[model samples]
Target: MRSAVQIADARANKPGHQIYAGRARAIIERASIALRSSTWVPIATGFIEPVLYLLAFGYGMGTLIGDISTSAGSIDYTVFIAPGLLATSAMNGAIYDSTWNVFFKLNESKLYQGMLATPLGPLDVALGEIIWALFRGLSYSIAFMLITAPLGLVPSWSALLAIPAAVLIAFGFASFGMAITSYFKTYQQMGLIQIVLLPMFLFSGSLYPISVYPDWLEFTIKLLPTWHGIELIRDIWFGVIDFSSFSHLIYFLVMIVLGLFFTTRRLRDLFMR
Candidate 1:
C-alpha cells in the first residue's frame, strides 16, 4: 500500500517539474544554430594564438628555462607550460563566448529581445547561453589537446582529465563573465574584462612557473581561479597528483556555483527591467 501511494505522489509531482521545459528547449535550440555553421574561420582563429604560444614559448624559450621543478619533480619547460596554455585557452574561449557573443545578442543584435517576446524568459536565455558556451569551450579544448599531441606533451591518463578540467574552468568563468555582463551597459566596460583577464592569463604562469614571481605576487595570484586551474592542469599533465589537486577541483566547482547564483539573479533583474 505504501509503495502504491509513493508512486501516485511521484506521478503527481512530475507535471509541475516539466512546466518550464518548453522555454528552455527553445533557448537551447536558438543557441545551437550558430554552432552548426561551417564557420571554419572561427576555428582557425582560435588555434592560431595558442599555436603561436606553443611554438614561440614552448620551443624558443624552453632552452632558457629547461626542466622546471614541481611537487612531482622537474619536467620539460614545455610540459609545465602546456597545461597552463590549456587552462588559458579554456579561460579565454569561455570569456569570449559569455561576454562578446552574449553582449552582441543582448544589445546590438537584439536577439535576446526577440526571444523575450516569445515564451523564453531571461533565466531561460541565460541558462541556455551558458550551456552553449560550455559546448564551445569543450570543442576548443579537444582540438587544442589534439594539436598538442604530436608535441609529446600529454604525459598520462590523468593528462586526459585536463580536458574536462578545462571544461569546468571555462564553465565557471564563462558564467561569471555572463553575470558581469548583466551589470554592464556598454562595450566600453566590456574591455576591462579583456584587459584584466589577459594580464591574469599571462601572469598566472601560462608561460612560466608561479614561483618565478616574487613571494608577494605569488600569494596574490594563487587566490585567482586561473591560477588554481593552471596549477591543477599542470600537476595532472606532469603527474604531480596530490591533495592539492582535489582542492583545486573544489575551488573551480565553488566558482561555478557562485557564478550561476549571481548570474541567475542578475538575469532575473535585467529582464524585469
Candidate 2:
C-alpha cells in the first residue's frame, strides 16, 4: 500500500502535467553539443543554397530583366529578389532542423520521451527545438547579409533589420514544422514536406512578381506563409515599413502561438498519457 501511494504521488508531480519546466535551455545546450559532432556538409549546403540563388537570379537574370517596380518605386532586379531569398534561406534552415531533426528524435531516438521522463515538460522540448532551429536560420541570415552588403546588395542601414525579420520568419516555420512533424511516423511521409516547399518557393513571389498570375492565382499565392515572409522582409529590406508590414508580422505571430499550442498538446497526448 505504501509503495502504491508513493508511486501515485510521483505520477501526480510528473512534468507531464506542466506545460513548461523552464529548462528549455538545457535542450538547446544538448542540441549545440550534438551539432558540434555532426558533419558540416549539411550546414554548408544550407548557407550556400541561397547564395547560389541570389547570384544566379540577381546577377544572371537581372541583366535580362532590368529594373523591377515595387511600392518603393523602380529598383534593381537584384534588390527586389534579395529579401525573398533571405526569407527562403531562413525557411530552409528552420525546416531542416525542425522537420528532419525533430522527426529523428521523436521517432528513431525517442529523445523527447527520455526528456519527459526527467523534469522537462513538452513545452520545454518544443520551445527548445524551435529556438535551436532559429539559431540555424540566424546564422544563414547573417552570413548572407555579410556577403550581400559587401557586394552592394543591401541598400541602407534599415536593410540590416532583415536579419531579425529572417529570424521571425524562421520561428514561424520552425514552430509549424515541428507541430506538423509530430504527426508523421515514417520517412515516406516526410517526403510530402519537400513536395510542398519547392512549389511554395517557386510561386511565392520569390523570383518574380506574383501579379503576372491571374487574380485568383495571386490570391492563392498570397494565402501562403512564404508570401507573407517574403513581403515582410522585402518591406524592411527596402525601408517601406507600413501598416501592411505589421499585418504580416501579426500573421507569423499567430502562427507561432498556434503551432506551440498544438505541439504542446500533441506531445502530452503522445507521451504523457
Candidate 3:
C-alpha cells in the first residue's frame, strides 16, 4: 500500500498523465493563431531571403566563382550552397518558434499551469509545442521547395523527402531550443543562442564549403548536428544520396530524442521550483 501510494504520488508530481488532450488543444490553438495571422508571410519572408542569396550569390556570384568540387562531386557553387541554406532555414525557423514562443508561455503566460489544472503535464506541453514547430516547419519547407523548383535544384522525386527532412530538422532544433529555454529567465538570455547559432550558420559550410575551413574549425563544425543536416540536405539536392544518409538520419533522430528528454526534465524541474 505504501509503495502504491508512493508510485501514485510520483506520477502525480511528474505530469506524465496519459491522453493530454487539453494541453494539445491549447497548443494547437496558439499555433493556429500564428498560422492564420502570418498566413504566407512567414514562408514568403523566410524563403525570399534565402532565394535572394541564391540569386545574387549562387547564380550571380557563384557563376563567377565557378564549379566547386565536393566529395559529392563537382557542382555549381549555387547548387552546393542552396541546400545548406535549407538546413539553416529549418533550424532557424524551428528554433525561433520553440525557444522564444515556448519560453514566453512557460515563464510568462503560465500556460502550462492552466493546462496542468486540466490533467496535462510538462511533456505534453513540450511535445505539443514541437508539433506546432513541425507543422510550421513543413509549411516553410514546402514553400522553399516550390520556390527552388523552378531553379531545377531538386534532384529526384525523392526530393519530396526534403519537406519531412525539414520537419525532422525542426524537431531536433526545437526540442533542444526548448530544453535551453527552461534555464532562461528573460529574453536577454536568448542572445547567447543567437550568438551561438549565427556563428554556426555562418561557419558550418552553409555559405562556403567546410573543406575550405581550417582543419581545427572543420573538426568542431562537424561535431554539430546542423553540419550533418546541412550535408544530408545537400546530398539529396545534389543527387548524392547513398547509404550514408542513414548516418545523418540517425544524427538528427538521436538529437531530437536526447533534446526532448532534457527539455522535459528541465521543464519539470522549473515547474517544481
As a whole number from 0 to 100, the lDDT of residue 181 in candidate 2 is 96
Estimate the Cα RMSD of every predicted model relative to the unseen true structure.
5.3, 4.0, 5.0
Q: What is the lDDT of residue 240 in candidate 1?
A: 73
Per-residue lDDT over 1-273 for candidate 3, one digit per residue giving the tens place of the 0 to 100 score: 466445445556444454333355566786787677765665566656666767888878887898888887887787778788777778767876787777788888987677655555667777888878766666666777787778877666877777778888888888888888878887789778878887777777887888887899888988887888788888777667787777888888988898778877776676644
Q: Which candidate is the best by lDDT?
A: 2
TM-score of each: 0.87, 0.93, 0.85
Give the TM-score (vs. native) of candidate 2: 0.93
Return the top candidate by TM-score: 2
Candidate 2: residue 266 Cα off by (Å) = 1.3
Q: lDDT per residue, candidate 1, 1-273, as tens digits?
A: 567446445545544322223355666677677768746676566656776888889899888878987776778888778888888778767776788888887678878777665544566677777777776677777887998877788887668988888898888888888888867888899888878887888888788778878899999998998899889888778777789898999998888777777776766566556
TM-score of 3: 0.85
Question: For model 2, where is the 10-residue window of minimal lDDT?
Answer: 1-10
Stretches of candidate 2 off by over 4 Å are: 1-17
Instruction: Estimate candidate 1's RMSD in Å.
Output: 5.3
TM-score of 1: 0.87
**Which model is ahead, 2 or 3, in terms of lDDT?**
2
Return the lDDT, model 3, position 231: 83
